[model samples]
Target: MDTRNITYFIAVFEHLHFTRAAELLGISQPTLSQQIRLLEAEVGMPLFDRIGKKVVATEAGRLLHQYGMKMLQAEMDAKNAIKELRSENRGTIRLAVLPSDLDFQLVPLFVDFKTRYPETSLQAFSTIFVREEVLAHKVDLGIGLSGSLDKRLVQVPLGSEPYELFVHSASELAKRQAITLEELTQHALVMYPKGYLGRDLVDNVCREQGFELNTVMEVGSASSLLQLVEAGIGATIQPKELLKQHPEWSHIVSIPIADPAPIRHLELTYYADRFISKAQQQLSESLIEFFKSRGVGEDLELRG
Candidate 1:
């Protein structure tokens, strides 16, 4: 129950080894094990499963670790709040960034941010679960999938991004100017797992056209999907911005989806309750301005 014990528990869970966790925590292996046992006694359940040489978290351990991480992060956020008041220009800003955002938007934005706040540091995490991390205070801002979010979070709509069919130049479909939702079903497709916004859009269109989806390969990474498409193995659906950013995909052709393009809005997500430092606020403003200058700010909206 103690934060110190929770910290030790988190360290062990991260490394999944007593010696490594002890080294990281600056404590002896026996002491760390004793503390973990005391924590297990307090929680009334086993946290980890140590079988042979491997150490893994039990189901109970996973749940407790999630809560412990939130507690530790909240504590850090409180300290940062005080530091923000005392210090003028030196602090770390953690931002959870989506992979798609990195290639196109982040470099210029990062350059500007660093130029303005030279003393500040930026940590960018490539993640899809931005809202959860923001609420936990693990990140100050995040690039989220869609405009919709919980009432406790604040969001600024970046713009609506349409999914396009990425086909290999050698493929017959690449010669075509545009492709429809129905025609797209005829080819073997590379897609992400369910719950991804791009995947959801593909499913919606496929369902609307009255065809059972046939996936050739389910890929996890966006970069890998492009590689598969370029290899003529399968076609993938991705955002226009993402494809445009990666111009090195000369063999990969991007075709605009027709008969109602699959579009979803991208947004900036942050917790309303968390303190937004001056540098954070400035970066947010600059991002909004960047979007505006790009001529995609018509549907912009702010919500808490």
Candidate 2:
């Protein structure tokens, strides 16, 4: 019945080892066992099957685990709401950032944020995409080369990350300042896997140019695609700003794709109806300001 007991139970169920779970929860094994016993008594069911050193959750335990997580998350959300009301400057920002922004933009902003509001905690999740995270309310904000999501979500356009041809030094495509989407199809390609926004954008443009892409290889991350391009395997496409960091990859040339210059809009997405705490608002403002300061004003647009 107790929330603390539920927390302890979930931790134990997750690890299926009392000692390991206790360590993770920063408590003693004996104390953890006592709490789990108390939880089992309250529920009137055996939560675990113990045989030798192995432990497994019983059917009841598995069901409780699912509900227990939802209860705990709701409790945490309530606590966060109260904390937000007490202090405008002190709180956490739950952000889910795409991998490219992790290095190019988010890290530096995080450094500055820590210095400015040392009391604030930043919970950052760096993933390939954040649309699902935002929709699930697991993250308060998300940044990516994407646009709108479900109708429940609202997006603030930051900028368009111009797609450029990333080619290895010896590749014939590296000789040009720009290549049309029509010309891009002539070479072999390394592209993002299907369903990824970047890959979708490239596919859309190539389709517009009246041909399917010659994607010889497919990769999940921008880094892998770039590495493959560097290895002279095939050309790939990525944001111009991300490519700017690796000048040493001078072996690679990033030329803008012309004739319907393909680009993905990088946007900040969040649930429109959710409460925007001061910490969240400030972080969003900081991102907008940072973009303007970096002279990306021409590319970035702040959505109302």
* The best candidate in terms of TM-score: 1
Tell me the tens digit of each residue's lDDT in model 1 across 200-221: 8778877877874677998777
Q: Of the candidates shown, which would achieve the greatest lDDT relative to the real structure?
A: 1
Model 1 weakest lDDT span, ten residues long: 97-106
Predicted candidate 2 versus true structure: per-residue lDDT over 1-304, tens digit per residue: 9789998998888789999999999999999999988888989999999999999999999999877866776777688788777766577789998876685556778989888878888998988668778865678898866654457777777766677888887987767878887776788889988888777887888787688887889988777888899899999888777777556676788887885877777678877766677778889888877766755534554453
Clashing residue pairs in candidate 2 are: none
Residue pairs in collision within model 1: none
Q: What's model 1's overall lDDT?
A: 0.82
TM-score of 1: 0.75
